[model samples]
Target: MNPPAEPPSRAALQAAASQRLHPLSWLFLLLAQLRAFALPLLVLLFGGGRREDGIADLIGLLAAGLLALTAVWRYFTYHYGFLGQALVIRSGLLQRNLRLVPFDRVQNVTVHQNLLHRLFGVASVRLESAGGLGQAEAQMDVLRLDQARALEALVRQGAQRARAAAAASGEGPEAATPAEPAPVLWLHLPMRELVRLGLISNRGMLVVAALFAALSQAGDAVMKPLGNQLYAGLKEGESWAASLHLGPLAYGLASLLLLLGLLALVRALSVALAIVQFHDFRLLAGERELSVERGLLSRVRAHLPKRRVQAYTLHESLLHRWFGRRSLSVDRAALETGNEAAALRELVPLATPEAMDGMLQRLLPEGSWPPRHWQPLHPRAWRRVAFPGLLATLAASGLLVAWKGLPGLWLLLLLPLVVLRARIWARYSAWSLEGGVISVRQGWLDRHWRFAEVRKLHALELRQSPFDRRHGMASLHLDSLGAHPMAPPLRIPYLPVAEAVRLAAALRAGMPRDAGVSRARTAA
Candidate 1:
């Protein structure tokens, strides 16, 4: 029998040149670089009085040539790299930076080939860290889809081999078996939801339009003075009319309109870019983790391992309710640097309530499903959500009335006071808890369900105010594991004494191990 062929060495496999950027990519880079340097070069050339300075001209030429060459070298070094068991990147001129990413630590590898990339036979690869900390490690402007796919497969195989080796050397069964694959759950937002979510998003085209209008107007005001001063400086020997004559008001108006038009164009382009990046976005729920992929220019892939997710929430705004859409967010305290963990880890733009419920079941551990419908422990729980705000408003109104006469004071505060009272009342609506999960619902014009597993809870607090003590009632706040700065822990404002104790008992009992048992408990 012929001897078994030797496996290719990592260095041998990586010896071949991968791919090159399309010629157009170089042109695009050149234009962007030129724009960045143009103003500085102009300042150097024109800022000083006209002088026959051959030395300055030669110096400028040499600097421009050096800058251009440096840009080309940097791009080549960063983009070209070798793929192996550990990522081997060769970057920099004098001191090379080599990044070695072990396969087991790689959460997910995503490949994106846009229209331009397709035309050029190139793609970008994103490597998300499985450990769920720090920004994703990315390789951009790479060459060819096949190479990236091959690299991903190689890494996966190496990870499996590594695990097997570890197991043979006395690792536990859990170490041998990679975490269970996450359930392949998908939630799609209908077009109706897109419009509704976009409308209420508060950061839509209208805001962009208004911002552009303000920016354009401001830019014009700033530029006019600079332009006039420049003209005065340049034409010092010319007549006053030649140097300082302002355009006719009609002409100025036309120019303003043109500037506004340009601003609108730029704004629309930016919005289009953002929309495309978020367009047709899908979030996949897996048994082991949550995966996210989005964007066009720079594709992004994020993995939130089940162990990393601190909290899971479902929210319905007024617009969402109207359009049958719900927003789902997963919080991971591991992402502590970000301001709002909810914003960063939103599963999808829009999904139905049923879908949201299904996803919640999949993401949380066994027994962690929010009770769909249950009576609040306290009949006056609504009062808890609303009363404080109402009392504050009324007190403010009284103070104002005492200081000022009733004539305008009532006008100033009556409608607002009524609105506040109505809002507080609405917010107090209802909250409930059952089985493995706790549900807290509140909103004046919108509603939400925050579902968290007992296992997911970092800590719990039971609070009783003076009034609560008088009424023999208390409040429960459940703290989930994520990094949402603005999110208050789930608050159950009013719970009667007995029911509060019962709920606390169940929470402490811990979730049952069997999936069926957990479901049965929730049903019970």
Candidate 2:
């Protein structure tokens, strides 16, 4: 008898249907690359009569030619397909890469459209997977807007099938049937609220914007000479005050006036940025997802799975607190892969304390969602705060004396400010655990009322520093899935040592019994 035919190899058995990106993908890729060079091009345009144009033009043309060639090459070489339980992409012109993204592991599918894409009627699609760290596992760089949406629907169907198959065999994460989220408006921030958000936000961002504007506005003749002078003075070790030939007092006064002018400019720019970025801010909560859409000239539409929201941070700056307003953000797990678009979203531009609490209740429904009463930390917390302020005051005094000589004695008047700060910290910094939530209210100058559902807590710890131990105090720290480097740490510092340990234990008790309990093995 003929030997049984050898079983088909995996690749042969699971055939992939190959496809190319949208034909307009070349233009999309080319523009995506060219956008980064826009700043450099603008800088060259303002060469201010200090530089010749011929060399710059030649270099720009060559760079543009190379970028276009690469885009063309990439479009021709790349291919993607649905292949046996995975979406596989074979890409790269010189060195090929094969990426197989399993349907069961897909975390999210994102669609993006910019002005150029919208103008051309094409969009971008990104497939996010677990552990990808904020970057898409595979992206369909350009497609018709409807096509992108269709691709997203296809992925969701695949994921649902995978989950259903797993459940049939008694293993797999369960999810409800996927459906289009009918838009439900939770909040629509008005222009007035956006303006208030501007006042509370940082004004320093204006300096960066102004610097870019100056590069484009000033000619090479103006910018180059100014740059050379600043560079030469720095290389020569001459202070700016000394270089101007002004006396110490005149230099000091002039510097102060310049700073005041900068502050005014920053305030104006902040207002403009707020108006531009949040002109028609709208938040929508759906059955399975939450979406935020904002921006005036260019738009951004971002969504987060409701179950993937790991934490919430409400920031109330001193100015905001004074005005009885707070801003809210949610940490989305989609950012774990380092996706810039999936970072923490400001859900509320500006709201009163009561309004914020109501929003939180709607977002995280627990027995006692946002516990009102906060337990005060150890009294020593204020002393811990006081020492740092005093140190800062002393440092400021020394710097002033070195800069302007005898006039620096004015720094002594700041001692009262330090005392006031300590009192503020003593009054506001506290935490509590009520019902099934962990609540913390913190900050002296800029305050926030933070809370998380206990069932969501992933990890907890208690620690004591040398100072903390000496003062009979410890700190309690909580870790959730979506930790952001820029967001504030969830820590309650300067709590009684015993209290801190108790809090840790309580959080451990609150965790899911089926998930976190460690099993002890008996000796074999």
Candidate 3:
């Protein structure tokens, strides 16, 4: 190489005119249009699900044309540039939008490449900001991979500089520019593990979705005609419906079997989804950063600072438990509230419990784990846990009796199953406090291991509803830096009142006063 060009000066960037995305963006926009109108496209190709051919075609063409027009307009009008420490993006068709996102508030920067972009050698860059407050602070739909990486690097630098400025404002040299980030590959899912992950992940959810789509699409055309034929056959033969009788217990058993069958179907679908999404999953740990790369159909590279993680969960679904493995998700402090995808970053696709321990140790050496005794909640915790389940069982039985007459009394059989589940939960759920960290083992059919450093604790609360109060039971609730919808709190429910108060008090006093990031945010 002759010489590396000097990085452009900040002043130069300030003087640069706003720029539109690469012309190739039109292709990306067209793909977006197709994705947005996928249902309509299905109706066009397969027919029957929607209205008449004429009406469906008219709506489909109008929607596609409108989507295409909007994409073109957005591509042409959108412009982005840097101004001092802020990134600015302006765009609009009839109205106008000029957004200036300060680097200090930037929470994440990600580079994404789907199959189409791969063919075209382009990527999309998203600069996410504080708490996902509004649509990403700024995003570039199409850029050459090299240019996208450069922009991501620049965004990271701007955020670093802003942090330095903030730190120096109060504590001179205390938060001086941190050392250069040193990245190390800590964990990469192997092909064998990927297969195991596929076997255990949530394919059931996809199966349910597929079932709904089939009903919505082909119900009238296929199911109705099929149902008519079945009815005709039944009328011509013995009328089995009139001869059969079912007690509530028989009904309950039938329902249970049906549910189990449905669950199996869902599990099968989840396995397929896991393979496609986690074909080459990898996690890299650094001094102050974390990197994740995964996806088979669409390559995704996610960059995260260690300080940004608020909390993480180690989940063991029933299927996963059978395979002796667990999955992990990390919640970012600045993640947007409703972004299901970005908010839950997969820390590990799948690993045996022992391997999970090793991986966590490699990524978090200071973090504690077993060989220590686990402390279960109070023995009487079973009472509180079982109370709700009993009430529900009774209510359901009563409803069945009212609707189906005396035979419905057999519904009482469900109560035992509910109570058994509660008993299992009380037996397995436990919490332990060690070395400034709190670990909770939760879930009954599925298991979860959640960790939070006590020093990084943000807030603590003790709760005792009337039901809990009647039984001298209380729950200790703790809040850490990160928040997530899927991530449950590091809570110990149905503990003795004294234990709850004592735990809450200890956490409040032990919380870190000097360090900025807490246990969940630690890099290692």
Question: Which lDDT values do the candidates have, in the order given?
Answer: 0.59, 0.74, 0.74
For residues 1-524, could you state the per-residue lDDT of candidate 2 as single tens digits? Answer: 33434543446423452678889899889988989787776556444344454776776678789999999998888777786567877788579676777787876776767678778888788777657776678888898888888877788678767776676555655644444457688778798887777777865486677888988787776789988998997777557556778878886898799898988777777877887777788877776667777777555555567777777888888889777888887766656442225323566777888977777777776557667677998987888888877888889989999999978879978888887878788778888788777878887767776667778877676667677777988887776776667778887878897887777777888886643432111112
TM-score, candidate 1, is 0.64
Cα error, residue 244 of model 3, in Å, equals: 23
Q: Give lDDT tens digits, candidate 1, residues 1-524.
A: 33534654645434433444433444345545777888777656655656686666676677677777866775665534444445555456587664556665665555665555666666656666634564666444454567766765665566556565557567535356544464474754444444455555544455567866865765655678877998987577346435566568855786799798876565555445445555556576665556665654544444455666666667778777777778777677455233122324776666777877776666554554656565545765555545666677677767877778674356445555655655574445566555556677666566666666666675555667777876777766667645476554576666786777676666656633321111111111
Clashing pairs in 3: 202-270, 203-266, 203-269, 203-270, 204-266, 204-267, 310-482, 456-518
**TM values, all candidates:** 0.64, 0.76, 0.75
lDDT of 3 by residue, 1-524 (tens): 23434655644553453777888897688887788779768767567655554777786778778888888888887878877787877778579766777787777777888888888899998877656754676778999898899888888888778778767676334385765576778778777787787677765576678877887767667888878998999696545533567667876897799799877776667666777777687787766677788877788877777767766688988888788888888766665532224423677768778877876665443647652668788787877778878888788888988999888889788888877888899999888887667778889888887877776667666777777777777777777765676687778787887887777777777876643322221111
Top-down TM-score ranking: 2, 3, 1
lDDT of residue 329 for candidate 3: 81
RMSD of each: 10.4, 7.7, 7.8
Q: How many backbone clashes are present in model 3?
A: 8
Q: What TM-score does candidate 2 get on C-alpha atoms?
A: 0.76
Clashing pairs in 1: 182-286, 182-287, 182-288, 183-286, 183-287, 382-428
